[model samples]
Target: MLKKVAIGVDIGGTLTKLGIVDREGNLYAHMDFSTTMHKGFGDYLDELKNQIEGLRSQIDFEHEVMGIGVGAPNANYYRGTIEHAANLLWKGIVPFTDELKTRYDLPIYITNDANAAAIGEMIYGNAADMKDFMVITLGTGLGSGIVSNGQLIYGYDSQAGELGHVKIVDNGRLTGLGIRGGLEAYVSSTGIKRTVFYLLSDMMDDSVLRDYSYNELHGEIITKAAEDGDPIAKAAFEMTGKILGEQLANFTAFSHPEAFFLLGGLAKAGKWIFDPTRKHLEENLLPFYKGKVKLLPSGMMKKNAAVLGAAALVWNHLQE
Candidate 1:
């Protein structure tokens, strides 16, 4: 057993989550911070270094720091940088991993956040026993990490599994990726909001939602309303599921993974997402895969999935 620990960084458009994880997949210390704004690469890196070094001030443990693993939006495993991230306010490619590695003098590995989440599932979550699987992150955008034969399928240039960009509703809605009618256009946070707004106005009596501005409204609000038996909220979830399920059917045919692990904000909607997702997935799947594949929740603790997954990148490299 290693006495030291590796740091896992889960970078998102909204927040950055990180933790110190041991070889045994145990998380020790954790931090939540904002992603470096359009604040150039160096500025972003310095901010992260300061936050990480600050952790030493709080913990009184006797262990060495091993390395670092990062998960970010559009992170290219081949380039070790984040490319054209819309939410991060980045205009072009930024070499986050390389810059951080030079500053910290530590081995660093980086990949897209969704891929990290999938690896976390493989090494520490529900897919630990499976060789082929998919991990989907349903937040502001839909992200996916593909695992086949117990290894991440980064493909050439480390840009292999981009499940979100897969077109589901052609010409349906524009997405962050410059594609119209992609899966995220249907199932992402904004999609859910649109669904709710439409339902509140056109489908059901949504007095609860009609009161809030779309800017102030969020997926959580819809979930809460559903919990309170709001039919409009329920309709929104069902419609979201119908879209995701249709997309999954196509994804399943191509990958044939044993299971798909879901994480992120919209995923937390629970049955509001699951029930409809499951219903649509089964309805769309071919007869051959009808009863074969499974849709399991993250086996890794809910909030801990991203951190553990980022760490898994390090642990996975070590094991290799």
Candidate 2:
């Protein structure tokens, strides 16, 4: 029997990762290139095409290639376009699928990376047995995908479940989107960094974090500082967890998911992040919802998760 696989492409601001994955989410072949290398969309597409051909060559001839699936920022599933992605070189609405179709005769699908992560969870991760769940991606900024009744919720405009944009405070920290009080502005990597600065000012505790400038600090550095018993860094995690947990409790009132899987950079903080989040989440939940929802890490952590998610998107749409 011929092996079946799908081509998964995950486009980020700096890097583009593509891989061939089986139905089981097992990665077969993978490669990456700098997304910023090409200044124009057409040039980028040509480079992507060449990369895909090179990746396909690594697999045996007996394998049957399926369709291509892409996970990108601001990607529209219904329209098959990337609309005004803040980080991409391409501006406005780029006809992503149409352009790909012009080059390759195959079924192509696309969605925002967060939604792809949710589908990937449903198909291959720990959420494989879960019908309803939400995934919170905690990277430079927060992104979320909500699944209810075994379906990913795409609102009327193919843009729904933006949990990160929900206002959690009045006139709070501003985000890159120029929005204030958005949850992402408080609970993401950048959010925690901001919290650290606030803590440093409010508390006069001696700490190593004070030595580094704003540009030099990142999630890993802060995590290390917290691990080494830095008071300011630890406090930042506490504050972030409090805000995220309170908002999560509020979100539960809306969808009541079976679980919320935390993925990405900040989540890697382990106990520094999870302990406080779990504590506050339970504390804030209504009595009826208490102890009902489980908080878990993503099962796709060990693999090329984004690529698998993109491929899972293809397998899922094909089944539908």
Per-model TM-score versus the true fold: 0.91, 0.97
- Residue pairs in collision within model 2: none
After superposing candidate 1 on the true structure, give the runs of residues whose Cα lies further than 4 Å from its correct spot.
Answer: 37-40, 89-91, 204-207
lDDT per model vs. reference: 0.82, 0.90
Largest TM-score belongs to which candidate?
2
lDDT, model 2, position 49: 96
Model 2 Cα shift for residue 121 (angstroms): 0.8
Local error of candidate 1 at residue 281 (angstroms)? 1.2
| Candidate 2 runs further than 4 Å off | none
Model 1, total clashes: 0
Worst 10 residues of 1 by lDDT: 35-44
lDDT score for residue 195 of model 2? 91
Shift of residue 186 alpha carbon in model 1, Å: 1.1
What local lDDT does model 2 show for residue 287? Answer: 100
lDDT of 2 by residue, 6-97 (tens): 99999999999999999999898999999999898988999999999899898875687789999999999999999999999899999999
